[model samples]
Target chain A: MESGTARIAVDLLGGDDAPAVVVDGALRAVRADPDLHLLLVGPAEAAGEVIRALDPAQRARVTVRPVRTVVGMADHPVAARADSTVRGAVHAVRDGAADALVSAGSTGATVTAVALGLGRWPDVRRPALIATLPAVAGPVVLLDVGGSLEPRPATLARHAALGTAYAAVAHAVAAPRVGLLSVGTEAGKGDRARRLADPILAATSLPCDGRYVGLVEGYDVSLGARADVVVTDGFTGNVLLKAIEGAYAMAGGPPTGGGAPRAAALLGVAGTVVVCHGAARPEDVAAGIGLAAHLWRRRATDQVRALLDGTEAGDREERTDRTTDTEVPTS
Target chain B: MESGTARIAVDLLGGDDAPAVVVDGALRAVRADPDLHLLLVGPAEAAGEVIRALDPAQRARVTVRPVRTVVGMADHPVAARADSTVRGAVHAVRDGAADALVSAGSTGATVTAVALGLGRWPDVRRPALIATLPAVAGPVVLLDVGGSLEPRPATLARHAALGTAYAAVAHAVAAPRVGLLSVGTEAGKGDRARRLADPILAATSLPCDGRYVGLVEGYDVSLGARADVVVTDGFTGNVLLKAIEGAYAMAGGPPTGGGAPRAAALLGVAGTVVVCHGAARPEDVAAGIGLAAHLWRRRATDQVRALLDGTEAGDREERTDRTTDTEVPTS
Candidate 1:
C-alpha cells in the first residue's frame, strides 16, 4: 500500500499446506499491491504455478528462486541434511533481492534462520515476535508470540522496551501506554516470573514518550482500553493469541474491526521479517506479505533501534515502588 | 433444574458489586428454581433486602444467616477483624445446613476456607478450579483456572486425571480425551513447565475411560475440535479464560452454544462449591448458584473423587512415549 516498490521474499514451501496455499497467497499479494514485487523461494514448479496465474505485467514483477521443501523441526534430525526454503528466502533478503521476507513456516525455524542469516539487534538476546491485534481503543501491540518460550526476567525487561518502541514506530501511536501481562491487574498478582518482572518494567524508561502502565490482565490484550502495548513471555503470548483467534471462530465471526492477527513482525531482527501462522489460510499469507511491505516502507526496525539506544534498564526501583494505584480495573 | 431439592449457601459479601447484586441474584435464583433453597450469609440488612424483594411463596425457600460483611483480602488484614461471610457459608455446608455453597469472593480465600473447613481429597496438594466452556464439539472442560498459580509437573498430571473425571461426572462427557495445554501440539514445544509436564500427562492413567491426547494448543480450549478436557497450570488457565471472555466481548457476544462460564467448580474439596468471577454481574451470580445446585444434584465431587481413587500416578512411562501419535488434528 506504500508508494515505494517493496520486494518481499515468499517461502512457497513453508506451511503445513505448502505450495498450493503459498502459490495462491503470492498471486493474491501480487494482484493487490501495484508496487509490490515477490521473489518466490521454493520448487520451480510451485513458483511456476503462481507465475502462470498472473498476467504479463504482474508476472514481470515476480521472480523465482528454486529450492525443495525441507522442514527443520527439533524432532527431525535428518531434516538438517536438506536445504530449507525458509533459509533460502532469508538468503534472498540478505542478498538484497528482496526488501523484506515473509514466511508461514515453523516459527522456531524462521527465528533461527533469520537470526543466523541477517543477524540480530545488538541489545536483544531473545528477539520478540510482535503481533498487533485490532482492539476497541485501536491496535494493541503484543510481543514475544513464540520468540523465546522461557524468557528470563531481564529478557522480559528488554521486551518491555522493545514493545514500547514497536507501538510507536510501527503503529504510530503517540505516547503508547505499555503494560506487563499477568493473571490479574492487581499488584503482587501473578506467578513467580511475573512478580519479578513487574518492578523492572515499572522503572524502565520507554521510547517515543511511552508510559509504563502497571500490570494489565488478559482482557487488555483484546479490549485495549487500558494499555496500547502489552509485554509477555513467548509461551503465554503465543497461546493467548491463538486462543483469541479460536474464541472469535467460536463466536461465529470476528468483531466489525477485524480479528486477532495471523501475521507477526519479527522484532530485534536486523531486517523486516514477518511470520504468518503455520496453519494460516491463503488470505493470512497475503496479509503477512502486506505486513512485510508496510514494515519495509516504514523503516520501523531502524527507528525502534534508535529509540532504545540510550535508555538504560530499570535500576531506579525506589521511584517506581508500588505506592500508587496499580490495578487496571477489571470491568 | 433437577428433581431433588438443592440447598445452596450464598455469600452476600463476595463480589465487587456485593450486597446489591447478591441480593438481586438470590431473588432471581429462588424465583427460577422451585426446588432450590438458599441460606444468605452476610449482614442482616443485606439479607433483609433479598427477603423484601421476594414474594410470600418464595420467602419460604430462603433462610437468613446474619453475619456482618467482612473481607479477608491481602490489602486489608485488619478487615479480618470482622467475621467473613465466605467462612460462614463454608461452615453452613460443613454443618449440613446447605447442600452446596456459592461465593464470588477472593478465590484464594475461598479455597483456603473450603480446604480447611470441608477438607481436601487425599493427595491433591493443590485443588483445581474447573470451568466448562461451551464449544462447538460440546463442553470443553478446563481445570486449574486459579487453584494453584504454580503447580509441579505431577500436579498438572493429577489435574489431567481430575479434569477427565469431572467431565464424565458433571458434564456426562464419555471417555473424555484429556490434553495438557501448551504452546503447540508438537511433543517438544512449550515452556520449561510444559516440557516437564507433557510426558507425565501422557503416562498418567485417566479416570472414566479417559485418554491422554498429548500437548494441545489454545485453539483446542474454545473450538473443542481436538480435546474434551484441557489441563493447565492455574496461572495460565486463569488468564486464558479471561482472554477468551474478552475476545467474546470483542466478537459482539458468545455463539449460540453459550459464553464462558462465569463460575468454576472447585475440585479436590469435599463439598460442591462454585466460585464466580469477582466482577460477576447479577446474572453471573445467579449462574453460580445454578452451577452449585447442578453440581450438588449430580453428586459430582464425590463421584469424581471415587473415579480418581484407583488411578495410580503416571509411573509407567514405557507404554506412553513420544513415538506415539500425539497431535489431535484440528479441522
Candidate 2:
C-alpha cells in the first residue's frame, strides 16, 4: 500500500441500495485503510452510520458534508442538479476537501459532475471510463466502458493516448501495446468508425513509448495476449466488460487471478474519480474507494494529462514540418 | 446420435493450421458418430492422410474431392477463386454429395461461398452466423457472430426471428425470450440502430411464441438470465462470443456446463453450414463437424426458414392493415 493520507469523498446515496450499501462499503474502506480519510456527502443519517461503525480513535478520520439530492438512473445525464449528492462529492474534490471521489451512481451523472466540477483536460471532449481486467499477460486496460456511447473517430484517437498513459501511470506497464478492439485482427475488420480510427491511431504518437498493435479481437481484452491496452467505443466496451464478468460467474468461479472488476476509473477529467457499478455490493464499493485512493496517491490523472499534453505538443511540431515538406498527390 | 446418416463436406484447407487440424477433426468426428460421413475437400495428399488413418470399414464413410486453392486470411471475401477449397465444400452440398458443410476458413469467404453455391433464403441479404452459448438458464443463441458487421434495423429484426426459431427448433427452447443486445436494458439506451430496432422487434410477431424482451446487456448473453436468444450486429456478436471464450480460459477452465462455442452455425443459407475458428484445434474442428451433423439431422435450417416465411407473411398482413386503417402523424 502507498504510504500517504488520501482523503476520498464518497457519495452516500448513489446506488440502488443507497445509504445502506454505501454506509457498509464506507465503513469497510475506513477500517481497511488506516491513512484513508472519508468525506461522506449525502444524508446525515447515512454519514452517522459510517461514523458509528468506526472506533472512537478512527472516528476522526471520517467527516460529513450532508446533501439530499440524487441523480436517478432514469434521469437524463445533461441535467446538473445543484443539490445532487454526486455534485457535492465532486465539489469536495475541487475544493480540496477530498483528494479524490467515488460514486456508485448513474455513470453519466458522475462523469458529468466530475467534468463540470474539475473541468476537462484540454482537447478531451469525452472523458473515458477505463476498466482494467486481469489476464494472463498482465492487466489489460480497456477505455470508454461507458463514457461516450457513440464517439467520433477523433475521440477514439484521444482515448488511445489516455489509455496508454493510464496503463503506464496506474499499472506501471512500460511501453504498453495499444490495440483497437475489432471483430478480427485483419485490417478493415471493424465498423466505419473503427476502420477510420485504425489508421489514425497508427499514425498518431502514443504516450509512455506505447506502440499501436493495429487491430485486436475480443480475446485480447480478457487474455491480454495481444495488447496491454484495448480501446473501443463506450457501447462495445461496456457490453464486452459485462459479458466477461457473466462468463466468469457461469464458469462456477473466477480465475485465480480474479474476476472482472465492478469499478472503473474515469479518465480525461482533471480530477481523480472512480465509478462503481450501480448495482454495486459492499465489496464493490470498497474496491471503488480503494481504487480512488490508489489513483489519487499515484497522481494517475495528472501524469496521464501531462503525457497527453506532451504528445499533442509533439504532434503540432510534426504537422508544421510536414506542411513545410512537399505534398504528395491527393487521393 | 440421430439415426439418419449426416454427410458433411469438410474444408480441409480452411484454417490457419489447415489439413492437419481438419484431418484430425474429421477422424475424431467419424469415430464418434457411426452414422456420420465426411466428403473431404482439399489436396489429394491431405485427403489420402485422412483415408489412411481410418479402418477398411470406416473408409467407406470417408470420400475425397480434390481442390488446390486455399483462401488466404487477408484475401477479400468477394474473391471466390475458382479452385478455392471453401467453394469445393459448398459445391459438395449443392451436388447432393453432402448433407451439410463445415469450414474453418475466413468467415467472410465461407459465408460468400455458401451464399453463392446453395443460395441464400429469399430476402436475407446477410445470413447470420449463430453461436449457442451454454448459460445458467439454458442455451443462449447469439446471432450475427460475424456475418453482417453493421446490419440495418430491418436486418436486426430479421435476425431476431431467425434466432427465436433456432432456439426452439434446434435447442427445444419453448417461447424463447428474444432480446436486442445493447449497452443497457432500458429503452433508448443504445446507439441509433438499437434504439430503432427495439420497437420493430417488440411489434414483430415471432414464431414458436417467442417473446421479445427489451434491450439486454452483455450479461444477458453469458448468464442467460434475461433472455434465451440474444441478437446483435455481426461485429459485436463475434467479439462478444470470443471474449466469453477467453474469460472461460482465464478462469482456469470452462464451467461444469461448458464454455462459449468455438464453432458457430451459419443460418439463412439453404443448407446447414458450420464455421469453426480459423485457429481451430482438432477438438474445435470435431465440434464444428458434430454441430453440422446435429443441425442437419434436426432439419434446423429448413424449420427456421419455414418459421421466417410464416412470420414475414404475417408481417405483410399487419402492414396492409395499418395502411388501410390510416397512418398516424409521422414522427
Best by TM-score: 2
Pairs that clash in candidate 1: none
Docking class of 2: high
- What is the two-chain DockQ of model 2? 0.84
Which candidate wins on lDDT?
2
DockQ score of each predicted structure, in the order shown: 0.65, 0.84
lDDT per residue for candidate 1 within B103-209, as digits (tens), equals: 98888778888887899987787999999999998999998898898999999988988899899998999999998888888788888999999887877888889
All candidates' chain B TM-scores are 0.92, 0.97
Model 1 residue B141 lDDT score: 96
Worst 10 residues of 2 chain A by lDDT: A322-331
Question: What are the runs in model 1 whose C-alpha is more than 4 Å off?
Answer: A72-82, A313-331, B72-82, B313-331
lDDT tens digits, residues B1-331, model 2?
A: 7768999999999999998999999999999999999999999999999899999899999999999999888898877656799999999999999999999999989998888898999867789999999988789999989899999988898899999999999999999999999988878788888889999989888999999989999999999999999999998998899999999999878887778888999998999999999989999999999999999999999999989998999889988988977765455
